[model samples]
Target: MERKRDYMTVQELTENEKYKFWYFKIKECKESGLSVKDFCDKNNIKPSTYYNYQQKIRNILC
Candidate 1:
């Protein structure tokens, strides 16, 4: 039997990784035109967590 991939959780992100996480996410969204659910499915992230990140990025930009 094959095991599912062990995905990283949002809480495990180091302070420095925040920039990288957001950058890649925005790039993927902008370039691929993927919805949050689609992007999360492709990247193995949870929707709620992705929402939190989106808010964070919005805060940073504003």
Candidate 2:
């Protein structure tokens, strides 16, 4: 059986795609009842990098 991927490296995505990707990830993390560090660890993302993307998303919205 083939497994599907739920994540992609930011470099493989276009600029807008990257934003949306991280935005959804942040949202998913928030709704998963997991702390940011735990979520990042489970997802293979660095906590600092996740926080940076979260800040970037917020800056875009604000």
* Best candidate, TM-score: 2
lDDT of 1: 0.77
- Model 2, residue pairs in steric clash: none
- Name the runs in model 1 displaced over 4 angstroms: 1-13
| lDDT, model 2 | 0.93
- Error at 12, model 1, angstroms: 14
lDDT of each: 0.77, 0.93
Q: Across residues 1-62, which tens digit of lDDT does each residue of candidate 1 receive?
A: 97775965666557549767776787677688888789889989898987887787877778
Model 1 earns a TM-score of 0.62
Models 1 onward score TM values of 0.62, 0.77
